[model samples]
Target chain A: MIRSLHIAAKDLKAEFRTKQMLNSMVIFSLLVIVIFSVSFGDLLGDSETVSQLAPGVLWIAFTFAGMLGLSRSFASELENGCLEGLKLCPVDRSAIYTGKAISNVVIMFLVELITIPLFAVMFNYNIQGLLGLVVVIVLGTIGFISVGTLLSALTVNTGTRELLLPILLLPIIIPVIIPAVLATGKILVNGDISDISGELRLLLVYDIIFFVIAQLVFEYAIGD
Target chain B: MSTNSQKINILSILTAIVMFIAAYMIFFYLPQMRDTSGQLLDSSFKIFYFHLPIAITSYLAFFVVFVASILYLKKGTHNWDVLARSAAEVGSIFALLVLVTGSIWAKATWGWYWVWEPRLTTSLALFLVYLAYLMMRQAIEEPEKRARLSAVFGIVGFASVPLSFLSIRMWRSAHPLMFGPSAQGSSGGLEGTSLQFTLIVNFIAFFLLFATILAYKVKNENLQEEINAKKQALP
Candidate 1:
């Protein structure tokens, strides 16, 4: 586990030095919000309808931006035989998976942090249940990244890595996406943590299930 | 080779006989359904026989895929990989049939070809997951690498089937719950003994058909592998 943390730190150090992926993810998510705002210009005036739509919009931005970041997660390792170097390390293959998942989740959270507030500002919506929303976001992002990291490694060696990743990832992640969207909507509209307990539990279960599955299968995914 | 062909011939014959019996029972043997008010239901109700069995059969195929994938990963053998690939291909076909038949049934009963109901959405998700599985196989050239990566995908993709099955119970679904306890109540079960019997017959028929197709597909794949091996040895 500590080795996993060390690997994550190494990835963060590299990522922070360049900030290329982080910049693109944040900017891309902001653009998604901008486009949504433009498209729903007429509906923006009504707080009721805007609130109804905000949860879906927020998750779309997150999913799309997260896809961008995940596709790059293993692609970066391809440079300078960094993947080979990582594999040669004494730690287990699952350690690499955990490390990559951690970095992906951290990057996704950073992107969401920037995107969510801007989304509120542009949509002219007031935030409620901020704590609940954070809980939902954290669980949802963890679920997404757990599966996304494993699939990223799987697709990286394919000829159509970028195209194949989303095709393969999206359908599999439907369980995660549904509950997260529902919970986000509940928190944003009703501000009742109690109302979204079911969704939160579902998200939590999905995170654990997929994370464990990914750990067990990560060896085959990255094996030579 | 002769025995193998004979076995396949016997399975195909059995499948054809059972399928004919099922079709006859579905259309002619069973009485037409009526609502509680004694109004005659539309003939589209018959599609349920095909739709439910096909859906279950598809689930069976994916379960095979899941098992074969794990075996392939554990043993690192080519046969398990071949079996997984064959099952996934057949499963995707059945999954697509489930969607198509379901849509037709929906249009006749619900006045819409589709809805955002949990069952329908999850079925679509299931189909797309396997479709992605097949596409991923095509994207890779190396046989071993393709097998390993797709084995992982097959295992992960099968997780959707249980979720699809449980979606109706998990959420308030518009889809009818024909058997077992549902979230709404213990309603929506077939009323007549004949209806239940015909459903059972159709289930057997479809399962046989799935097994037949899967057998043929696996044989074809093995033959293809052999040809490739021979060509490689030519030099």
Candidate 2:
């Protein structure tokens, strides 16, 4: 566990150093928000509705941006052949998965932090229920990263890694999105946690299930 | 060589006959449409005999791919890889049948051909994922790498099936069966001997049809391998 955390911390530091992945994700997210605001100016004129849609918008941004970041995780590792060095280490392969998943989650959380507030200011929306919303994002991020990390490892060696990850990841992430979107949307509308508790529970279940399965299967997925 | 070819031809003919009989039973013996009140509005509900069975068979085929993928990873045998590919191809075709029969059923019963229902949406995503698997295989130049990579993807892809189903259910879709069929164990849908028998026969028939197609696909792959080996030996 300590080794895994060490690897995770190292990954986080490396990711922040150059910032290619983070920069692109942030820029693309801002562009999406800008396009939405410009095109749906009248549609989102109602501040209340915009606030309600904020959670959905935040998730959408993070989900797409996270896809790029996940693919890049492997792409960057392979470009420098760092995976070989890591594999040569005296660490369990699942630890590698844990490290990568944690790093992906952290990057995705950072992206979410930026976009959620940006969404609020853009639409002049009062975003409350912050705690529930953050929990939803974190759970959803775990769910996405769990599966995404495995697929990234699988696809990175393929001929078209970039094209392959989304095809593989999107379907698996559906279970996560359903509950996350529902819970987040409910919170966005200031709905009580009890009202969306079912979705939250489901999200938690999905995260746990996928994380375990991905860990078990990640070795086979990346095997020779 | 010609005599062996003749034997294989006969087997193909037999499979074709069985498929035709299944189709006949589905279209003629099955009821086509029925109302929600458990009343046989008309015999048009017979299409479901084919529709429901094909859907079930497609899911079964995907499961086979999943199993074969596990075996490939376990043994690293060429045969399991071939089995996975054949299953994927046949699964994709059955998936096509699911879409077609589903649209027909929708048009007859729901007054529209398609709605983004939970089941249908998942089926669509399954089709696309496997179709991409096929495309990825074709894009790669190395057969070994292609087989290995696609097998990995196939196993991962099948995991998505349940996810899509559950997700669609949790988040309501525009599909007519929004709440899904009653789980209260009521005779809400099926009624009468004709409807029940047709549904059962349809399921059996499609199940057999899938088996036959899977056999043919595997055989074709085997023959292609034999030809490649022969050519390589000659050179």
Number of the top DockQ candidate:
1
**Mind giving the per-residue lDDT tens digits that candidate 2 earns over B121-180?**
677878887887787777666777777777777877787677655654465555433223
- How big is the positional error of residue B226 in model 2, measured in Å on the Cα after superposition? 3.1
lDDT of 2 by residue, A54-82 (tens): 66666777788888899898778876668
Candidate 1 DockQ, CA atoms? 0.85
List, residue by residue over A1-224, the lDDT tens digit for candidate 1.
Answer: 99999999999999999999999999999999999999999999998898788888999999999999999999999999999999999999999999999988888988999998899899896788899999999999999999999999999988899999999999999888988988898888878788898888878888998999999999999986
DockQ comparisons of all candidates to the true complex: 0.85, 0.46
**C-alpha lDDT of all candidate models, in order:** 0.92, 0.76
Off by over 4 Å in 1: none
Model 1's CAPRI class is: high
All candidates: TM-score of chain A: 0.98, 0.94
Question: What C-alpha RMSD does candidate 1 show over the true interface residues after superposing them?
Answer: 0.7
Show model 2 residue runs off by greater than 4 Å. A47-56, B1-18, B30-44, B164-187, B230-235
**Counting only residues 3 or more apart in sequence or on different chains, how many pairs clash (N, Cα, C under 3 Å) in candidate 1?**
0
Q: By summed lDDT, which 10 consecutive residues of candidate 1 chain A come out lowest?
A: A185-194
Q: Give per-residue CA lDDT, model 1, range B1-235, as digits (tens).
A: 9899899999999999999999999999999899888899899999999999999999999999999999999999899999999999999999999999999999998899999887899999999999999999999999999999999999988888888987788787779988777867745767889999999999999999999999999999999989999999996
Residue pairs in collision within model 2:
B30-B46, B31-B45, B31-B46, B32-B43, B32-B44, B32-B45, B32-B46, B33-B44, B33-B45
TM-score of predicted model 2? 0.88
